[model samples]
Target: MIALVTAALAPGIALLSYFYLRNEYESRTFTQVLRAFIIGALLVFPIMVLQYALEAESIFEAEWLHAFVGVAGLEEFFKWFLLYFAIYRFVLFQSRYDGIIYGVALSLGFASAENVMYLMALGIDSAIGRAFLPVSSHALFGVVMGYYMGCAKKSDPNNFKLWISLSLVVPIILHGVYDLILLTIHENVMFIIVPFMFFLWWFALSRTKKANEKMA
Candidate 1:
């Protein structure tokens, strides 16, 4: 009973955390955030399905390859493209914070789906750890990516591709490093990685503040 409850709630908590962090954006309304969340999830679903299908084919059978292609590669690719092509190009993403908003929304979408899968596999009790670590890290990576996008937009139109590439690279590197760390299955790298993530989160928050200040 306890395990089942944990499994179900873990995904909920992960989503809640994404929203909570995203609320750092002062200009965005709750309704807008919800809408972005929905759009992001819908956009990312196809990629998740692809990851599932590809993994099933044994092409992603290698443990290291699984982390690269199955986990980090597919997921980051989808989220990055969603924010870049779907929201950035179509929406009124004029300000830097808008980039953060879209980026985090993309992360939440990815996180929500991934959490549901883990909760089903490991159940609720084991979810406490995931909620604390992997869940938050995913969203934070999006923030980093989003920050770069905002900088690109504000800087020079010609440099947009460079910025976009960075936006994707930052998340992929963070995600790939974390996934590889966990795949080791025997190290206390979590201690190192957790603090490292905190640094990244802090840096992202500071950049958002800078953007807000610039907008002001």
Candidate 2:
């Protein structure tokens, strides 16, 4: 029973909290933000799960190429799609906060799916550690991307392309580094990743805060 609670509740809380923290913007009504978030999250979930499953099952070990590009590229592509379509295309988002809110929402969806899968595979212990770090880190990355999207949205027409391009490329590089660190966990080097991930998240959050301040 306790195990069941951990499986369900931990992922649920993590998903909720990650997005909630990113919802610091006053632009989106709760419902508008929630709507875009749910739609975008649902859109990305299956693609992420399938990619993880295929990579995990591949006979070729988790090689450098696969870990670096396949892992980062696939996830980054979907999130970029969410930014492109849900946040950018939809005239629905007027305020910059909407971008961050929706970005975090999509990330939470991916993370929630990931957490549930990890828990089911390794049981409660893995889920507990992931409950904070991996989950929150993904959301923070989304917040950064969302902040840039807002800036891009407000920028000159030609410059918008450059900002959008950077927004996608930058997150993928950061996420790729994160995957690199995890691949070495069997080497007992998990501790090295904690500080770096902390630093990365802090940097991302600062950018997000700056974006919000600019909007205000």
Candidate 3:
């Protein structure tokens, strides 16, 4: 059981640490990051309940709708809400890269919990795949979300709306497409997913670099 828990959480912890420690300009205290993580972890339960309710009601009959609206929409919306309301105006959020740090923390928090539950049901053999795919994907999605959020924080009133909207919309779209690909492609899913993952990594790293450069 202990091993199982460790296996489930290790990937998320590693990713979270990578993003958190990469900030050179201003550092956020552990408490601030942990608070966001805990809040994000707590979000999984409500989101699960809501998803279950949606499923029970047959609210979304089509697979595409379920993937885009039911799953991606709900998950990203709550994460965005928390980032915008709970962490946006934080005292330590003075630096542009801080958004990436908090975003990664919250995302990995949720992803870690979700990964644990998934591994418990599917067993340990699935851990590697989950780590590479779902967990990493969540972190990348957070990068995209956080990048725009950081922009919104530093933007003028005229541009604030655009950045903030992209913060939510971009993640939803990327997450939705990710789910759609997995749901629709049964055989050789990795063929498509691999390239997609590569794109995510490149895009996320570029965003990270841009945010860090802006800090200078």
Q: TM-score: which candidate is best?
A: 3
Report every candidate's CA lDDT.
0.70, 0.68, 0.90
The estimated TM-scores of all candidates read 0.78, 0.81, 0.96
Counting clashing residue pairs in each candidate, in order, gives: 2, 0, 0
TM-score of candidate 1 relative to the true fold: 0.78
Prediction 2 global C-alpha lDDT: 0.68
Error of 1 at 84 (Å): 1.8
Assess candidate 3 and give its TM-score to the true structure.
Answer: 0.96
Candidate 1 residue pairs in clash (backbone atoms < 3 Å): 6-124, 7-124
Over 42-61, each residue of candidate 2 has an lDDT whose tens digit, in order, gives: 65557766776877778336
Candidate ordering by TM-score (highest first):
3, 2, 1
Pairs of residues clashing in candidate 3: none
Worst 10-residue stretch by lDDT in candidate 1? 16-25
Cα lDDT tens digits for candidate 1, 1-216: 655645644554455454446443445456665665676567546876787788678887677787776888777887777677766766665567667776776677666666666777877766778766776777777777777887777767898889888988877877877777777657787677777777867877776677665542
Error of 2 at 180 (Å): 0.8
Task: Say which prediction, candidate 1 or candidate 2, comes out ahead on TM-score.
Answer: 2
lDDT minimum window of 10 residues, candidate 2:
4-13
Question: Candidate 1 at residue 183, lDDT?
Answer: 78
